[model samples]
Target chain A: MKIGFDAMGGDHAPVETVKGAVDALSLIEGEIVLFGDELKINKELSQYKYDQKRISVVGTTEVIENDDKPVKAIKRKSDSSMVVGMKALRKREVDAFVSAGNTGALLAGSLLKVGRIKGISRPALCTIYPTMSGASVLVDAGANAECKSRNLLEFAYMGSLYAERVIGINNPKVALVNIGAEETKGTPLYIETYQMLKETDLNFVGNVEGRDVPSGKVDVIVADGFTGNIILKLTEGVSLSIVKELKNQIVKNSIGKIAGLLLKRNLGDFKKQLDYSEYGGAPLLGVNGLVVKAHGSSNAKAFMNAIKYAYIGVESNLVAEITEKIKTMPAFEAPVENEEENE
Target chain B: MKIGFDAMGGDHAPVETVKGAVDALSLIEGEIVLFGDELKINKELSQYKYDQKRISVVGTTEVIENDDKPVKAIKRKSDSSMVVGMKALRKREVDAFVSAGNTGALLAGSLLKVGRIKGISRPALCTIYPTMSGASVLVDAGANAECKSRNLLEFAYMGSLYAERVIGINNPKVALVNIGAEETKGTPLYIETYQMLKETDLNFVGNVEGRDVPSGKVDVIVADGFTGNIILKLTEGVSLSIVKELKNQIVKNSIGKIAGLLLKRNLGDFKKQLDYSEYGGAPLLGVNGLVVKAHGSSNAKAFMNAIKYAYIGVESNLVAEITEKIKTMPAFEAPVENEEENE
Candidate 1:
């Protein structure tokens, strides 16, 4: 299988993307098709030693900047790496597409270019949240800020599948993210979502609060994009701040500085466990094809981990599984209609 | 001024409450009216040395258990410490009420017993988010999970007041918490709220993403309770997990073990900053009377800090200020009504 890599994306762009693609070739058996300006891609590729046959560069002139609006940029910049890589994925020229560029752009391209799976109204951006027990997958992390009950229902199933097939959690415990563990918490949207989520055949674990997310008691936590985005980013912000605090604390006194020297390796390991990059980038699930959105500030190692995700997504047939799962799952009875009919 | 202490509330009951009241006596001139089983409160208070005249006990027959439904429990248990404390505050027997028990019960009593300020639809729960620069006040942290645009505007002004009057940030920079920094980021509620918030005489800093809260870029971040609650608790979860992770990392090996000993002091200082107890309790703002909800797991020190918050809230006349501020501010332009009138 061939993987299309958006080499001209993310903060490090061509350099890290090229190096990451080369790193992935060492692990998996897939040809890497780099989509970017050929000169820049070749310049970065020259430094790495790899079989020239395993990697190929596709030249694209336009580059989507980080600040560009998602829908506008994707529609305007036809030759951009993100847009071009998506085209390759659409035509089935590549098995999957991966980009670490503008998250908004990648999400838009997934819907506009690669398109949504038939019958799925919205494609969710999954975020891999690191927890004490292991990892929890949060869906619609920033895709739809506002969601209907059906959207949440779809996310629950999609997230559960990804957790089971890709992450290898058997019978993954699914929970709705709410203010309280009780069914009564959250707004009207959550209340409706909770009622429907519990009725599903999935291993429903009821409600899990924000505090429960990092605790990792539940395997998957589904939330609307607005709430999910806040949770995802707040977790990142808190982790970053804590790491910063730890580094500052380590150098305070002579004794503390000496102690930091001894604990450096363990500290690094702890940081790795907390880091999102270790899980690779989150795949934009519920779409017609596999598309991974890596962190915009991704380094080579982060990008490589994201590339590995492409391998997992393809091998697990996550999209097809979700599509099939969608058909078998009981449909969400519209709350308004159901209530009206009952009355 | 006098403060009513719910001596039977929280995980640590009369023991912690009595101890915290004793601790507060040295700093403040107010009398502490303890509400609980008189015998139990007196027995706990006997251990601590303080002015007998400064502290008094008001016996109550019932206690609100943590698991009880908030609104029902408050209505049924008039003899409970939380309800009795609110009653005392309503009658001007105490300037403020502080509790560490069931959060919902305290919030319910705050509305049902003490009541909301004139014109405030729903009282907000203000959580003091500790950021790198300083502390930022997040209003409606877990109060109204579903909010209209007007509710958010009320929270923004209330948060700004609390930040300025209590937290001591002069003309605090206020920002709306959204999925994105753009004004068009969140749902229709946020967009309308954003337009009105800009028109107010607040130190309006525009939209702040989730990361900005911990980064301490803005002094007040106002969000509908659904988003705010998730942000508040997620921060707690992340901090708790990081603290747990750090403890594990500190004892990995002999070298690390020794490093942990030397670095203990710095870690303690860092932990103190992240500790919710350090800031005392979160204030239930927008109510007619001052009510502070201490953490359920609060110890003596945490209870004392919460009591300290009570003193600050009363001294600043926070509720009165919010009431006055609400009246002077221009009303939120009803989008549909305005459009219809224009046509």
Candidate 2:
């Protein structure tokens, strides 16, 4: 097995990505293929001592920037690390593709380059949301801005399958993110989606409000990408602000400074639990091949975890399971027809 | 001026509500009219000493429960504390109405009982979003679950006016809460709303993603209630969880416990900063009268703050200002006609 790593991706670029790939080699038996500028990749690779045979490079020239238009970059920058890595995954040259590059570009590449599963209407971006009890999967984190009830139904099944297969949560509890717990709540889309989810074979746990999201009571939270994106970004921003505020409070007084020193180690651990890097990356589920999008500002550790996450996705055969279930499931078949009839 | 208070609202009921009213008397010049069970209001009020002449009780037999259907409760329970308080506000018997009661009932009563300002399409529930710098107003927090582009335009104007007249911000930066920073991003509704905002006299700061919300870069965030409700609840939940997690981390070991003791005051201050109670209540904007919806689990401090917030609203003549501006604004006029043409 081989994992395609975008060495030119993330804020740290080849430095962090190369270091992360080298560190990750010890944990997996699979080989790592670095896709980026050959000289830069090799320069960073030389710093670490590793089994040289297990690591390889497929150098590319163009780099898709953070601000680059997602689809435009994917189509235009053919030799870019992201596009090259995506092509490699599509061709089965690599089992999974991992990148900490532009999230929009990666998602666009996943659909345009790697393509989608035959039965899936839209592939969702699913993230591991760290919670008090454990982690819950937040689907369609930022893929589709507007969604239909059919799309939400697909996200629900895909999210549930990912939870069961990759995350290993048995009979994963799937819940629609709504303002109220009742079926009557939310817009026409959510109301329609609620009825669809209720009849599914999956373990559908009614509705959950935004407050219930971090409680980890449910394994999978299904939301339209617009709402999910807002949730994703807001959670990150609020948590980050709180942690920064804590540091400020700690340095305010002489007594607080002393307490900060004594509690530094515990604080570090607590921050780690809240950190996005600890969760690795959000998987672009329902894409024909496995694609993992690490945070754009990822460090070496974060990149390493993302690669590991991609490996887990490949090993668990998440894509295949979703494809099979979506094709065969009776619940999945009805929504498409119902939607068409409505239109 | 007189303020109508729901004595039988919220989790703590007459105990907290009556105490809050008593505590609030010294902060304002207005008389307090407690509307609920007369015996229960007096029973709790007797525990506190105040200017007896300033505090009066108007006994209402019915009390709107948290679970009661909003519109139904407002219509059927005419003698309910919420309904009665709303009626008093409509009739100019009270300058404003404040409650820590069923939010849906309060919002419904504000629209159905007190009514919307003339020419206003809809009244939004706008809340004070506590941020790192200070606080920003989040409009349509949970009023209209679904909204048209015109409603959002009104929300933007109303939210901006609330920030200026009530919150005392000069030329408050108004922004649309969207999935992206781009005007072209988001659904067609948001795109249309974006163009409408740019044409207005408002200090339109362009689009803001969910991450930019807590940064306090903008003074007013305009969104559909479905999205705004999620943002409101999620912010509250995440902040609460972080505080709880910090407490757990502090008590996990002996060294941490000592640090926790020394840092307790700072943590307490930090918690107070994040506390929803500190912000008082979400005002039902665009309504004919001032109606503030306090938190459901509000204690005396929260309820007291809500009353003070209502007092400020009355003093600023917020409802009158909004009513006047909305009628004169050209941006407000165009969209209503455009929507009609499309239909």
Candidate 3:
């Protein structure tokens, strides 16, 4: 098996990507295929000592930027590293594709180039969100801005499968992120989704309020991309702000400075628990091919983690399991309004 | 001016309420009317030495609970302290009303008893959200779970007026909380609201993503109640969890314990900055009369701060300003699609 890496992706580009690939080579028995400018890839690779037989470079000329519109860029930049990597995954040239480039472009390429598994209505961007107890799989992290009940039902299955398959959790509990905990709470969409989830065989814990999200009572949390995206970013912002403020407070006076010095190692450990690098990349699930999206500012370590994530997805047969899961589910049908018709 | 205080509200009931009222006597030249059982109010008031003429008690028997359905509790419990206090405000017996009881009950009483100002369609729950730079007024905090663009428009105007009048900010910057920073981003409701906000005369600073919220780039952030409530609770949850985790980490070892003891005062200062008591209560905007909802678990300091918040609202003629602002705005009319007929 081989994993395709977008060597031209992320802020550090070929340098960190090359280092990450070399770092990942020791962990997996599979080959690493680098897709980017040959000269740049080789130049970065020269700095690292690795098994030359296991690494190969498939040079691509173009690069998709963060500012480029998702669909337009995906359609126009076919020669780009991200698109080429995705194509390789589609053709089974590689087991999985990983990129820390533009999230929108990766998602667009996943849908337009790689396509989705049959019977799947939408693909969700699922992230492993860290909580006090442990991390929970947050589905539809920022893929679909608006969603229907059917879409949420699909996310529940996909997210739960991800937790069980790749993350190695058994029969992970699933929940809907909502304003209130009641079954009747939230908008018309959530209320309908709640009923649909209740019917499913998955361990569907009732609605979870925003405050309870970090409590880690459930394993998988599902919501529309809009709400999910907000939760992801807000949690990040609040955590960052608190840490910054805490540091400022700790260094304000002589005693504070001394105390801060003594507690430095413990604080570092605390920060590591909330670090994104520890969690690896967010996966674009429901796609026919395994597509992982790393952070834009990913460093060597984070990129290496992303490669590891792709390896796990490939080894665990995530795509086949998801396809089988979708096949077994009943086909979706829009609810017909008999009551309104009678009225 | 007279302010009605719910003597039987909050976890620390009559004790905290009476103390809070007495604390306000030195700060304001107005009378405090405590609404609850006369015996309980008097018993708590006896502990505090204050001007006898400045404080009075109005007896009430029933109490609205946190678990009670909002509308049902308001309609049935007319003799409840919350209901009695609402009646006093509606009858112009008190200039303002303050409660730390059930938020839903307070909001229900605000709309049903006190009514809304003429030309206002909805009353929003606006909270002063703490941020690194200072604070932002978050409108529709949890009042209307679902809202249209018209409701958002009203919230924007009311929230802006609040920042300018009560919060003492000159021409506050207003922004819509969305998943993306662009105008075309977010759900249909937010996209429409963005367009509507751009057409207004307010200092509309376009869209703000969740990560930018804690940066305090804008003074007034507007969102639908569902989104706003999630943001509010998630911020609280993340902050609390981080603080708890930090404390746990600090006392794990001997060196850490010594450092923690030394850093206690600085950490206390840090916690104080993030404390809700420092910000006081959230006001129910667009109501015909002033109504402030404090935290349910409020202590004497927080309750006192809530009273001060009410004093500011009453002194600023908040209701009159909102009434005049709404009167000047064009009446909302649903858009009629003439193009549909042509098609």
Candidate 2: segments with Cα more than 4 A from true spot: A334-343, B334-343
Model 3: how far is A294 from its true place, Å?
Answer: 1.1
CAPRI grade of model 3: medium
Candidate 3, B196: how far from true, in Å?
A: 1.1
- Residue A239 Cα positional deviation in candidate 2, in Å, after optimal superposition: 1.1
State the weakest 10-residue window (summed lDDT) of model 3 chain B: B334-343
Query: Can you give the DockQ of every candidate in the order shown?
Result: 0.75, 0.81, 0.76
Question: For model 1, what fraction of the real interface contacts is kept?
Answer: 0.83
Residue B40, candidate 1: Cα error in Å is 1.7
- Order the numbered candidates by DockQ, best leading: 2, 3, 1
Report the lDDT of model 3 for residue A283. Answer: 88
Candidate 3 residue runs with Cα over 4 Å from true position: A328-343, B328-343
What is the C-alpha lDDT profile of model 2 across B113-208, one tens digit per residue?
887776678789999999988989999998889999888988988998899988899999999999888898888889999998888888999999
Better candidate by DockQ, 2 or 3: 2
For candidate 2, what is the DockQ-based docking class?
high
Task: List runs of model 1 lying over 4 Å from the truth.
Answer: A332-343, B332-343
Best-fitting candidate, scored by TM-score: 2
A-chain TM-score of every model = 0.94, 0.94, 0.95
